[model samples]
Target: MIKTSTQNELIQYVYDELAKNASEQLETAFMHDEELAESCSELLQIQNLLDNALKSPHKRAVQNILNYSKSLSLQS
Candidate 1:
């Protein structure tokens, strides 16, 4: 099993948040450890998915906000 700290490092590495030295060390570990390398690959895939995921509010949510604003304005 991977250590918790190493798992955290994997996340940081995936996000490009790891320090240069630490990143190099992790890469070195990756060459010898297939599990660690696979974990990193999975994280990269998830990060890519999140980066491309829909970011806007739902249409219903926007309409609800607009309706609430109109109601408040009518009371004022």
Candidate 2:
């Protein structure tokens, strides 16, 4: 069973959002708490997938916007 402290620590650890000391503590807890480690791994995977998705061409249209703006500028 994972302790509440470990569960809470997972939130920051999974995303690498904790300070160095806290992150180290969380990693130690993760090594000892199977449930917490699994939860953190899942969250980390999901976050990584989401980050990759955001970087996909369909997810970001900045280039299209810039091209359109350039065309408009040329017309004006």
Winner by lDDT: 1
**What global local distance difference test value does model 2 have?**
0.78
Candidate 1 clash figure, as a count: 0
Q: How does model 2 score by TM-score?
A: 0.59
Q: How close is candidate 1 to the true structure, as a TM-score?
A: 0.70
Error of 1 at 70 (Å): 25
Judged by whole-model lDDT over C-alpha atoms, candidate 1 comes out at 0.96
Tens digit of per-residue lDDT, candidate 2, span 22-44: 88877787787787778888888
TM-score of each: 0.70, 0.59
